[model samples]
Target: MTAEPAVVAPVLPAALRERIVAEFPKYPEKRAVLLSALHFVQDTFEGWIPQAVVPEVAALLGLKPIDVWEVIHFYAMFNSEPVGRCHLRVCTNLSCCLRGARGIMRRLEETLAVRPGEVTPDGNFSVGEVECLGSCGTAPVIQVNNERYREGLSEDDLPGLLDELRTRLAEQDAAKDEE
Candidate 1:
Protein backbone atom coordinates (compact mmCIF):
# COMPACT_ATOMS: atom_id res chain seq x y z
CA MET A 1 0.00 0.00 0.00
CA THR A 2 1.12 3.58 -0.72
CA ALA A 3 2.06 5.79 2.16
CA GLU A 4 -0.34 8.59 3.15
CA PRO A 5 0.61 12.21 2.49
CA ALA A 6 1.22 14.52 5.46
CA VAL A 7 -1.53 16.91 6.49
CA VAL A 8 -0.50 20.54 6.72
CA ALA A 9 -1.60 22.71 9.66
CA PRO A 10 -2.51 26.36 9.28
CA VAL A 11 -0.10 28.94 10.67
CA LEU A 12 -1.13 31.20 13.52
CA PRO A 13 -0.29 34.85 12.81
CA ALA A 14 2.48 36.53 14.82
CA ALA A 15 0.20 39.23 16.17
CA LEU A 16 -2.34 36.66 17.33
CA ARG A 17 0.39 34.57 18.91
CA GLU A 18 1.64 37.63 20.69
CA ARG A 19 -1.84 38.41 21.94
CA ILE A 20 -2.22 34.88 23.23
CA VAL A 21 1.14 35.10 24.92
CA ALA A 22 0.12 38.38 26.48
CA GLU A 23 -2.80 36.58 28.10
CA PHE A 24 -0.37 34.13 29.71
CA PRO A 25 0.45 36.28 32.75
CA LYS A 26 -3.23 36.91 33.47
CA TYR A 27 -3.76 33.23 34.12
CA PRO A 28 -1.79 31.04 36.49
CA GLU A 29 -0.67 28.66 33.74
CA LYS A 30 -0.56 28.29 29.97
CA ARG A 31 -3.33 25.70 30.17
CA ALA A 32 -5.48 28.23 32.00
CA VAL A 33 -5.02 30.58 29.04
CA LEU A 34 -6.55 28.15 26.56
CA LEU A 35 -9.96 29.81 26.48
CA SER A 36 -8.55 33.26 25.84
CA ALA A 37 -6.22 31.89 23.18
CA LEU A 38 -9.15 30.15 21.53
CA HIS A 39 -11.13 33.40 21.63
CA PHE A 40 -8.28 35.37 20.09
CA VAL A 41 -7.90 32.79 17.35
CA GLN A 42 -11.66 32.61 16.80
CA ASP A 43 -11.96 36.37 16.56
CA THR A 44 -8.99 36.45 14.20
CA PHE A 45 -10.66 33.84 12.04
CA GLU A 46 -13.88 35.86 11.98
CA GLY A 47 -16.07 34.05 14.52
CA TRP A 48 -15.30 30.35 14.28
CA ILE A 49 -12.61 28.01 15.50
CA PRO A 50 -11.28 26.10 12.53
CA GLN A 51 -10.35 22.49 13.27
CA ALA A 52 -6.86 22.92 11.83
CA VAL A 53 -6.00 25.48 14.47
CA VAL A 54 -6.79 23.18 17.41
CA PRO A 55 -3.42 21.47 17.29
CA GLU A 56 -1.67 24.81 16.98
CA VAL A 57 -3.42 26.09 20.07
CA ALA A 58 -2.62 22.87 21.89
CA ALA A 59 1.04 23.21 20.99
CA LEU A 60 1.08 26.85 22.06
CA LEU A 61 -0.48 26.03 25.43
CA GLY A 62 1.62 22.92 26.04
CA LEU A 63 -1.57 20.87 26.21
CA LYS A 64 -2.83 17.87 24.29
CA PRO A 65 -4.98 18.37 21.19
CA ILE A 66 -7.84 16.62 23.00
CA ASP A 67 -7.60 19.15 25.80
CA VAL A 68 -8.19 22.00 23.38
CA TRP A 69 -10.85 20.05 21.55
CA GLU A 70 -12.72 19.35 24.77
CA VAL A 71 -13.04 23.00 25.69
CA ILE A 72 -14.00 24.03 22.15
CA HIS A 73 -16.69 21.37 22.01
CA PHE A 74 -17.92 22.08 25.52
CA TYR A 75 -18.54 25.78 25.13
CA ALA A 76 -21.66 27.02 23.39
CA MET A 77 -19.94 30.36 22.81
CA PHE A 78 -17.37 28.68 20.59
CA ASN A 79 -18.17 27.92 16.98
CA SER A 80 -16.29 25.11 15.27
CA GLU A 81 -17.32 26.12 11.74
CA PRO A 82 -17.82 29.35 9.82
CA VAL A 83 -20.72 31.56 10.90
CA GLY A 84 -22.28 34.66 9.39
CA ARG A 85 -21.01 38.15 10.10
CA CYS A 86 -23.71 38.48 12.75
CA HIS A 87 -24.63 35.46 14.86
CA LEU A 88 -27.88 35.95 16.79
CA ARG A 89 -28.15 33.60 19.74
CA VAL A 90 -31.64 33.56 21.21
CA CYS A 91 -32.04 32.31 24.76
CA THR A 92 -34.28 29.23 24.83
CA ASN A 93 -34.23 28.23 28.46
CA LEU A 94 -37.49 27.95 30.43
CA SER A 95 -37.57 31.59 31.50
CA CYS A 96 -37.18 32.91 27.98
CA CYS A 97 -39.26 30.13 26.46
CA LEU A 98 -42.20 31.00 28.69
CA ARG A 99 -41.84 34.61 27.61
CA GLY A 100 -42.22 34.05 23.85
CA ALA A 101 -38.63 33.25 22.91
CA ARG A 102 -39.78 30.52 20.55
CA GLY A 103 -41.96 32.96 18.66
CA ILE A 104 -39.07 35.34 18.29
CA MET A 105 -36.88 32.51 17.07
CA ARG A 106 -39.52 31.47 14.51
CA ARG A 107 -39.72 35.01 13.26
CA LEU A 108 -35.95 35.10 12.86
CA GLU A 109 -36.02 31.86 10.88
CA GLU A 110 -38.71 33.17 8.58
CA THR A 111 -37.14 36.58 8.15
CA LEU A 112 -33.62 35.30 7.49
CA ALA A 113 -34.87 32.30 5.49
CA VAL A 114 -32.39 30.14 7.33
CA ARG A 115 -33.02 27.83 10.22
CA PRO A 116 -31.06 27.79 13.46
CA GLY A 117 -27.35 26.91 13.07
CA GLU A 118 -27.43 28.07 9.41
CA VAL A 119 -26.20 31.30 7.88
CA THR A 120 -28.12 33.65 5.63
CA PRO A 121 -27.54 33.55 1.88
CA ASP A 122 -25.46 36.74 1.88
CA GLY A 123 -23.39 35.45 4.82
CA ASN A 124 -24.55 38.40 6.86
CA PHE A 125 -26.60 36.74 9.62
CA SER A 126 -27.12 33.47 11.47
CA VAL A 127 -29.45 32.31 14.28
CA GLY A 128 -29.05 29.71 17.01
CA GLU A 129 -30.65 28.75 20.30
CA VAL A 130 -28.75 29.26 23.52
CA GLU A 131 -29.57 28.64 27.15
CA CYS A 132 -29.86 31.19 29.97
CA LEU A 133 -28.44 34.45 28.78
CA GLY A 134 -28.86 35.33 32.52
CA SER A 135 -31.46 37.97 31.73
CA CYS A 136 -34.51 36.17 32.98
CA GLY A 137 -35.86 39.48 34.25
CA THR A 138 -35.62 40.61 30.66
CA ALA A 139 -36.61 37.29 29.19
CA PRO A 140 -36.60 36.69 25.45
CA VAL A 141 -33.14 38.09 24.94
CA ILE A 142 -30.89 37.82 21.92
CA GLN A 143 -27.13 37.91 22.18
CA VAL A 144 -25.58 39.53 19.14
CA ASN A 145 -22.21 38.24 17.98
CA ASN A 146 -21.67 36.83 21.47
CA GLU A 147 -20.79 40.38 22.49
CA ARG A 148 -23.92 42.45 23.11
CA TYR A 149 -27.19 41.41 24.63
CA ARG A 150 -30.53 42.72 23.36
CA GLU A 151 -33.04 42.09 26.09
CA GLY A 152 -36.83 42.20 26.46
CA LEU A 153 -37.66 41.36 22.87
CA SER A 154 -41.08 40.51 21.57
CA GLU A 155 -41.81 38.96 18.20
CA ASP A 156 -42.70 42.47 17.06
CA ASP A 157 -39.13 43.58 17.66
CA LEU A 158 -37.34 41.20 15.28
CA PRO A 159 -37.71 43.08 11.99
CA GLY A 160 -36.39 46.35 13.32
CA LEU A 161 -33.62 44.65 15.28
CA LEU A 162 -32.46 42.72 12.21
CA ASP A 163 -32.55 45.83 10.04
CA GLU A 164 -30.60 47.81 12.62
CA LEU A 165 -27.96 45.10 12.87
CA ARG A 166 -27.65 44.92 9.09
CA THR A 167 -27.26 48.68 8.84
CA ARG A 168 -24.70 48.76 11.65
CA LEU A 169 -22.65 45.98 10.04
CA ALA A 170 -22.77 47.71 6.67
CA GLU A 171 -21.57 50.98 8.18
CA GLN A 172 -18.78 49.17 10.00
CA ASP A 173 -17.77 47.48 6.74
CA ALA A 174 -17.75 50.83 5.00
CA ALA A 175 -15.46 52.25 7.66
CA LYS A 176 -13.11 49.28 7.31
CA ASP A 177 -13.06 49.68 3.52
CA GLU A 178 -12.12 53.36 3.90
CA GLU A 179 -9.31 52.39 6.26
Candidate 2:
Protein backbone atom coordinates (compact mmCIF):
# COMPACT_ATOMS: atom_id res chain seq x y z
CA MET A 1 0.00 0.00 0.00
CA THR A 2 1.23 3.51 -0.81
CA ALA A 3 1.06 6.26 1.77
CA GLU A 4 -0.56 9.56 0.80
CA PRO A 5 0.86 12.91 1.80
CA ALA A 6 -1.34 15.45 3.56
CA VAL A 7 -2.25 18.48 1.53
CA VAL A 8 -1.94 21.97 2.99
CA ALA A 9 -4.51 24.66 2.28
CA PRO A 10 -3.60 28.16 1.27
CA VAL A 11 -4.70 31.06 3.47
CA LEU A 12 -4.89 34.79 2.98
CA PRO A 13 -1.95 36.68 4.51
CA ALA A 14 -2.20 38.03 8.09
CA ALA A 15 -2.26 41.72 7.20
CA LEU A 16 -5.04 41.09 4.74
CA ARG A 17 -6.78 39.08 7.39
CA GLU A 18 -6.76 41.98 9.81
CA ARG A 19 -7.90 44.41 7.18
CA ILE A 20 -10.80 42.16 6.27
CA VAL A 21 -11.78 41.77 9.91
CA ALA A 22 -11.60 45.51 10.49
CA GLU A 23 -13.86 46.17 7.54
CA PHE A 24 -16.21 43.34 8.40
CA PRO A 25 -17.74 45.59 11.01
CA LYS A 26 -18.60 48.18 8.38
CA TYR A 27 -20.95 45.94 6.42
CA PRO A 28 -24.54 45.46 7.65
CA GLU A 29 -24.45 41.73 6.94
CA LYS A 30 -21.69 39.14 6.77
CA ARG A 31 -22.52 38.30 3.17
CA ALA A 32 -21.93 41.91 2.25
CA VAL A 33 -18.27 41.31 2.88
CA LEU A 34 -18.03 38.96 -0.09
CA LEU A 35 -17.20 41.72 -2.58
CA SER A 36 -14.51 43.13 -0.33
CA ALA A 37 -12.93 39.71 0.11
CA LEU A 38 -13.03 39.11 -3.63
CA HIS A 39 -11.33 42.46 -4.18
CA PHE A 40 -8.65 41.57 -1.66
CA VAL A 41 -8.03 38.23 -3.33
CA GLN A 42 -8.01 39.93 -6.72
CA ASP A 43 -5.26 42.33 -5.70
CA THR A 44 -3.42 39.64 -3.73
CA PHE A 45 -3.27 37.34 -6.72
CA GLU A 46 -2.17 40.26 -8.89
CA GLY A 47 -5.75 40.43 -10.30
CA TRP A 48 -7.29 37.02 -11.01
CA ILE A 49 -9.70 35.77 -8.31
CA PRO A 50 -10.12 32.04 -8.80
CA GLN A 51 -13.18 29.95 -7.97
CA ALA A 52 -11.04 27.60 -5.90
CA VAL A 53 -10.98 30.35 -3.32
CA VAL A 54 -14.76 30.41 -2.88
CA PRO A 55 -14.80 28.09 0.09
CA GLU A 56 -12.10 29.96 1.96
CA VAL A 57 -13.74 33.31 1.37
CA ALA A 58 -17.11 31.91 2.37
CA ALA A 59 -15.72 30.59 5.61
CA LEU A 60 -14.08 33.91 6.39
CA LEU A 61 -17.34 35.75 5.86
CA GLY A 62 -19.45 33.27 7.85
CA LEU A 63 -21.48 32.44 4.76
CA LYS A 64 -22.30 29.22 2.96
CA PRO A 65 -19.70 27.86 0.53
CA ILE A 66 -21.95 28.49 -2.44
CA ASP A 67 -22.31 32.18 -1.62
CA VAL A 68 -18.78 33.02 -2.59
CA TRP A 69 -18.89 30.76 -5.62
CA GLU A 70 -22.03 32.48 -6.91
CA VAL A 71 -20.49 35.93 -6.72
CA ILE A 72 -17.21 34.76 -8.26
CA HIS A 73 -18.99 33.09 -11.13
CA PHE A 74 -21.37 36.00 -11.69
CA TYR A 75 -18.62 38.56 -11.97
CA ALA A 76 -16.52 38.48 -15.15
CA MET A 77 -13.45 39.80 -13.38
CA PHE A 78 -13.10 36.77 -11.11
CA ASN A 79 -11.23 34.02 -12.91
CA SER A 80 -11.52 30.30 -12.28
CA GLU A 81 -7.75 29.87 -12.60
CA PRO A 82 -4.55 31.80 -13.00
CA VAL A 83 -4.60 34.48 -15.68
CA GLY A 84 -2.04 36.92 -16.98
CA ARG A 85 -1.21 39.61 -14.45
CA CYS A 86 -2.04 42.39 -16.90
CA HIS A 87 -5.60 41.72 -18.08
CA LEU A 88 -6.81 43.59 -21.15
CA ARG A 89 -10.59 43.39 -21.60
CA VAL A 90 -11.43 44.63 -25.06
CA CYS A 91 -14.93 45.73 -25.91
CA THR A 92 -16.19 43.55 -28.78
CA ASN A 93 -19.83 44.58 -28.81
CA LEU A 94 -21.57 46.79 -31.43
CA SER A 95 -20.06 50.20 -30.88
CA CYS A 96 -16.57 48.81 -30.46
CA CYS A 97 -16.90 46.60 -33.51
CA LEU A 98 -17.99 49.56 -35.61
CA ARG A 99 -14.98 51.49 -34.37
CA GLY A 100 -12.34 49.05 -35.63
CA ALA A 101 -12.31 46.74 -32.58
CA ARG A 102 -11.78 43.74 -34.81
CA GLY A 103 -8.56 45.26 -36.09
CA ILE A 104 -7.47 46.16 -32.57
CA MET A 105 -8.17 42.62 -31.36
CA ARG A 106 -6.23 41.10 -34.21
CA ARG A 107 -3.29 43.34 -33.55
CA LEU A 108 -3.30 42.65 -29.80
CA GLU A 109 -3.50 38.91 -30.47
CA GLU A 110 -0.72 39.09 -33.03
CA THR A 111 1.45 41.22 -30.78
CA LEU A 112 0.89 39.11 -27.65
CA ALA A 113 0.84 35.87 -29.62
CA VAL A 114 -2.25 34.82 -27.70
CA ARG A 115 -5.96 34.60 -28.37
CA PRO A 116 -8.60 35.96 -26.05
CA GLY A 117 -9.04 33.97 -22.79
CA GLU A 118 -5.41 32.77 -22.94
CA VAL A 119 -2.46 34.26 -21.14
CA THR A 120 0.95 34.83 -22.66
CA PRO A 121 3.68 32.35 -21.71
CA ASP A 122 5.48 35.09 -19.81
CA GLY A 123 2.35 35.62 -17.60
CA ASN A 124 2.58 39.29 -18.46
CA PHE A 125 -0.80 39.73 -20.16
CA SER A 126 -4.18 38.22 -21.04
CA VAL A 127 -6.87 39.42 -23.44
CA GLY A 128 -10.63 39.07 -23.15
CA GLU A 129 -13.35 40.12 -25.63
CA VAL A 130 -15.82 41.74 -23.29
CA GLU A 131 -19.29 43.21 -23.62
CA CYS A 132 -19.90 46.98 -23.53
CA LEU A 133 -17.78 48.65 -20.88
CA GLY A 134 -20.15 51.67 -20.99
CA SER A 135 -17.81 53.46 -23.40
CA CYS A 136 -19.61 53.84 -26.72
CA GLY A 137 -18.17 57.29 -27.01
CA THR A 138 -14.78 55.66 -26.58
CA ALA A 139 -15.57 52.67 -28.72
CA PRO A 140 -12.62 50.40 -29.40
CA VAL A 141 -11.42 50.79 -25.85
CA ILE A 142 -9.67 48.42 -23.48
CA GLN A 143 -9.80 48.18 -19.73
CA VAL A 144 -6.47 47.26 -18.15
CA ASN A 145 -6.61 46.78 -14.42
CA ASN A 146 -8.22 50.05 -13.22
CA GLU A 147 -7.17 52.22 -16.14
CA ARG A 148 -9.05 52.50 -19.42
CA TYR A 149 -6.98 53.27 -22.49
CA ARG A 150 -9.23 54.51 -25.27
CA GLU A 151 -9.72 56.61 -28.41
CA GLY A 152 -9.93 54.57 -31.63
CA LEU A 153 -6.91 52.31 -31.14
CA SER A 154 -5.62 50.68 -34.30
CA GLU A 155 -3.53 47.66 -35.23
CA ASP A 156 -0.51 49.85 -35.90
CA ASP A 157 -0.71 51.41 -32.43
CA LEU A 158 -1.01 48.17 -30.44
CA PRO A 159 2.60 47.14 -29.94
CA GLY A 160 3.68 50.46 -28.50
CA LEU A 161 0.69 50.48 -26.16
CA LEU A 162 1.45 46.98 -24.98
CA ASP A 163 5.11 47.89 -24.57
CA GLU A 164 4.14 50.86 -22.48
CA LEU A 165 1.82 48.70 -20.35
CA ARG A 166 4.57 46.13 -19.85
CA THR A 167 6.92 48.88 -18.73
CA ARG A 168 4.36 50.31 -16.32
CA LEU A 169 3.60 46.89 -14.87
CA ALA A 170 7.28 46.09 -14.58
CA GLU A 171 7.74 49.22 -12.57
CA GLN A 172 4.71 48.36 -10.41
CA ASP A 173 5.98 44.84 -9.69
CA ALA A 174 9.47 46.15 -9.00
CA ALA A 175 8.10 48.67 -6.55
CA LYS A 176 5.98 46.02 -4.79
CA ASP A 177 8.87 43.58 -4.62
CA GLU A 178 11.07 46.25 -3.13
CA GLU A 179 8.72 46.65 -0.17
Candidate 3:
Protein backbone atom coordinates (compact mmCIF):
# COMPACT_ATOMS: atom_id res chain seq x y z
CA MET A 1 0.00 0.00 0.00
CA THR A 2 1.24 3.47 -0.86
CA ALA A 3 1.34 6.07 1.89
CA GLU A 4 -0.13 9.54 1.33
CA PRO A 5 2.26 12.43 1.41
CA ALA A 6 2.23 14.63 4.48
CA VAL A 7 1.13 18.25 4.27
CA VAL A 8 3.35 20.96 5.67
CA ALA A 9 1.78 24.04 7.20
CA PRO A 10 2.77 27.36 5.69
CA VAL A 11 4.71 29.58 8.03
CA LEU A 12 2.97 32.73 9.09
CA PRO A 13 5.27 35.74 9.39
CA ALA A 14 5.97 37.07 12.87
CA ALA A 15 4.08 40.32 12.36
CA LEU A 16 1.07 38.60 10.88
CA ARG A 17 1.11 35.88 13.53
CA GLU A 18 1.24 38.53 16.19
CA ARG A 19 -1.64 40.40 14.62
CA ILE A 20 -3.77 37.28 14.50
CA VAL A 21 -2.85 36.25 18.03
CA ALA A 22 -3.81 39.69 19.26
CA GLU A 23 -7.37 39.06 18.16
CA PHE A 24 -7.65 36.11 20.52
CA PRO A 25 -8.11 38.40 23.49
CA LYS A 26 -11.08 40.09 21.85
CA TYR A 27 -13.12 36.94 21.40
CA PRO A 28 -14.57 34.65 24.08
CA GLU A 29 -12.98 31.58 22.54
CA LYS A 30 -10.06 30.91 20.25
CA ARG A 31 -12.44 29.58 17.62
CA ALA A 32 -14.31 32.84 17.62
CA VAL A 33 -11.16 34.56 16.37
CA LEU A 34 -11.21 32.55 13.16
CA LEU A 35 -12.88 35.16 11.03
CA SER A 36 -10.57 37.97 12.04
CA ALA A 37 -7.54 35.76 11.60
CA LEU A 38 -8.73 34.68 8.17
CA HIS A 39 -9.22 38.29 7.21
CA PHE A 40 -5.70 39.15 8.25
CA VAL A 41 -4.27 36.28 6.22
CA GLN A 42 -6.46 37.05 3.21
CA ASP A 43 -5.43 40.69 3.27
CA THR A 44 -1.80 39.60 3.40
CA PHE A 45 -2.33 37.41 0.35
CA GLU A 46 -4.15 40.14 -1.55
CA GLY A 47 -7.71 38.86 -1.07
CA TRP A 48 -7.16 35.13 -1.56
CA ILE A 49 -6.77 32.68 1.30
CA PRO A 50 -4.25 30.00 0.55
CA GLN A 51 -5.45 26.43 1.08
CA ALA A 52 -2.21 25.53 2.81
CA VAL A 53 -2.96 28.09 5.48
CA VAL A 54 -6.19 26.41 6.50
CA PRO A 55 -4.62 23.93 8.87
CA GLU A 56 -2.41 26.58 10.33
CA VAL A 57 -5.42 28.74 11.10
CA ALA A 58 -7.25 25.77 12.59
CA ALA A 59 -4.27 24.95 14.78
CA LEU A 60 -4.10 28.53 15.99
CA LEU A 61 -7.78 28.55 16.87
CA GLY A 62 -7.96 25.06 18.39
CA LEU A 63 -10.35 23.94 15.67
CA LYS A 64 -10.24 21.36 12.91
CA PRO A 65 -9.08 22.29 9.42
CA ILE A 66 -12.61 21.59 8.16
CA ASP A 67 -13.92 24.22 10.54
CA VAL A 68 -11.64 26.81 8.98
CA TRP A 69 -12.59 25.62 5.50
CA GLU A 70 -16.27 25.88 6.37
CA VAL A 71 -16.00 29.51 7.39
CA ILE A 72 -13.98 30.42 4.31
CA HIS A 73 -16.49 28.73 2.05
CA PHE A 74 -19.47 30.32 3.81
CA TYR A 75 -18.30 33.84 3.06
CA ALA A 76 -18.19 35.13 -0.49
CA MET A 77 -15.68 37.76 0.54
CA PHE A 78 -13.10 35.12 1.35
CA ASN A 79 -11.56 33.77 -1.83
CA SER A 80 -9.75 30.43 -1.79
CA GLU A 81 -8.10 31.07 -5.15
CA PRO A 82 -6.17 33.96 -6.59
CA VAL A 83 -8.03 36.89 -8.11
CA GLY A 84 -6.68 39.82 -10.08
CA ARG A 85 -5.33 42.91 -8.39
CA CYS A 86 -8.69 44.58 -8.97
CA HIS A 87 -11.63 42.39 -8.02
CA LEU A 88 -14.68 44.18 -9.40
CA ARG A 89 -18.00 42.95 -8.02
CA VAL A 90 -21.29 44.11 -9.48
CA CYS A 91 -24.39 43.79 -7.35
CA THR A 92 -27.13 41.75 -9.02
CA ASN A 93 -29.80 41.86 -6.35
CA LEU A 94 -33.37 42.90 -7.16
CA SER A 95 -32.62 46.55 -6.57
CA CYS A 96 -29.50 46.41 -8.71
CA CYS A 97 -31.19 44.37 -11.43
CA LEU A 98 -34.06 46.83 -11.59
CA ARG A 99 -31.49 49.58 -12.02
CA GLY A 100 -29.92 47.98 -15.10
CA ALA A 101 -27.13 45.98 -13.44
CA ARG A 102 -27.29 43.38 -16.19
CA GLY A 103 -26.32 46.02 -18.74
CA ILE A 104 -23.50 47.15 -16.49
CA MET A 105 -22.27 43.57 -16.18
CA ARG A 106 -22.41 43.16 -19.97
CA ARG A 107 -20.44 46.33 -20.46
CA LEU A 108 -17.82 45.13 -17.98
CA GLU A 109 -17.50 41.78 -19.74
CA GLU A 110 -17.15 43.51 -23.10
CA THR A 111 -14.68 46.10 -21.89
CA LEU A 112 -12.59 43.85 -19.66
CA ALA A 113 -12.89 40.83 -21.97
CA VAL A 114 -13.68 38.75 -18.91
CA ARG A 115 -16.96 37.57 -17.45
CA PRO A 116 -17.97 37.20 -13.83
CA GLY A 117 -15.45 35.19 -11.75
CA GLU A 118 -12.82 35.70 -14.45
CA VAL A 119 -9.62 37.70 -14.52
CA THR A 120 -8.33 39.65 -17.49
CA PRO A 121 -5.40 38.26 -19.49
CA ASP A 122 -3.17 41.01 -18.19
CA GLY A 123 -4.07 40.11 -14.58
CA ASN A 124 -5.34 43.59 -13.87
CA PHE A 125 -9.01 42.98 -13.13
CA SER A 126 -11.42 40.22 -12.19
CA VAL A 127 -15.21 40.46 -12.32
CA GLY A 128 -17.88 38.89 -10.12
CA GLU A 129 -21.58 39.22 -9.39
CA VAL A 130 -22.46 39.79 -5.75
CA GLU A 131 -25.95 39.50 -4.27
CA CYS A 132 -26.12 42.98 -2.81
CA LEU A 133 -24.02 45.90 -1.64
CA GLY A 134 -26.82 46.97 0.75
CA SER A 135 -27.38 50.26 -0.97
CA CYS A 136 -30.87 49.60 -2.33
CA GLY A 137 -31.46 53.25 -2.99
CA THR A 138 -28.26 53.38 -5.01
CA ALA A 139 -29.46 50.33 -6.94
CA PRO A 140 -26.70 49.35 -9.37
CA VAL A 141 -23.41 49.45 -7.51
CA ILE A 142 -20.00 47.90 -7.94
CA GLN A 143 -17.32 47.18 -5.37
CA VAL A 144 -13.63 47.61 -6.10
CA ASN A 145 -11.31 45.15 -4.37
CA ASN A 146 -14.08 44.70 -1.77
CA GLU A 147 -13.12 48.04 -0.33
CA ARG A 148 -14.73 50.90 -2.20
CA TYR A 149 -18.19 51.06 -3.74
CA ARG A 150 -19.18 52.96 -6.85
CA GLU A 151 -22.91 53.42 -6.51
CA GLY A 152 -25.69 54.62 -8.78
CA LEU A 153 -23.83 53.40 -11.85
CA SER A 154 -25.01 53.09 -15.42
CA GLU A 155 -23.57 51.02 -18.26
CA ASP A 156 -22.09 54.17 -19.72
CA ASP A 157 -20.05 54.68 -16.55
CA LEU A 158 -18.15 51.40 -16.71
CA PRO A 159 -15.55 52.12 -19.35
CA GLY A 160 -14.31 55.22 -17.60
CA LEU A 161 -14.40 53.46 -14.27
CA LEU A 162 -12.26 50.65 -15.56
CA ASP A 163 -9.74 53.04 -17.04
CA GLU A 164 -9.64 55.03 -13.83
CA LEU A 165 -9.12 51.92 -11.73
CA ARG A 166 -6.33 50.69 -13.99
CA THR A 167 -4.61 54.04 -13.80
CA ARG A 168 -4.90 54.16 -10.03
CA LEU A 169 -3.55 50.64 -9.65
CA ALA A 170 -0.67 51.44 -11.96
CA GLU A 171 0.14 54.53 -9.93
CA GLN A 172 0.05 52.56 -6.71
CA ASP A 173 2.32 49.91 -8.22
CA ALA A 174 4.75 52.61 -9.30
CA ALA A 175 4.75 54.15 -5.85
CA LYS A 176 5.47 50.75 -4.31
CA ASP A 177 8.26 50.23 -6.80
CA GLU A 178 9.78 53.59 -5.83
CA GLU A 179 9.50 52.71 -2.17
Top-scoring candidate (lDDT): 1
lDDT of 3 by residue, 1-179 (tens): 98899878567777888899998888788888888898899778877898878888888889999999989999998998888888889899899999899999888888888977777887888989999789889879999885868999998888798789889989989999999
lDDT string, candidate 1, 99-153, tens digits:
9999999889988999877888888989899989899999989998858689999
Instruction: Give me the overall lDDT of model 2.
Output: 0.80
Q: Which residue pairs show collisions in model 3? A: none
- Deviation (Å) of 172 in candidate 3: 2.7
What is model 2's C-alpha RMSD? 3.8
True lDDT of residue 152, candidate 1: 92
Model 2 agreement with the true structure over 35-69: per-residue lDDT tens digits: 87788888887787765666677878898878777
Candidate 3: segments with Cα more than 4 A from true spot: 1-9
Q: Each candidate: what lDDT?
A: 0.89, 0.80, 0.86
Candidate 1: TM-score? 0.89
Off by over 4 Å in 2: 1-10, 50-52, 149-151, 172-179
User: Which portions of model 1 show Cα errors greater than 4 Å?
Assistant: 1-10
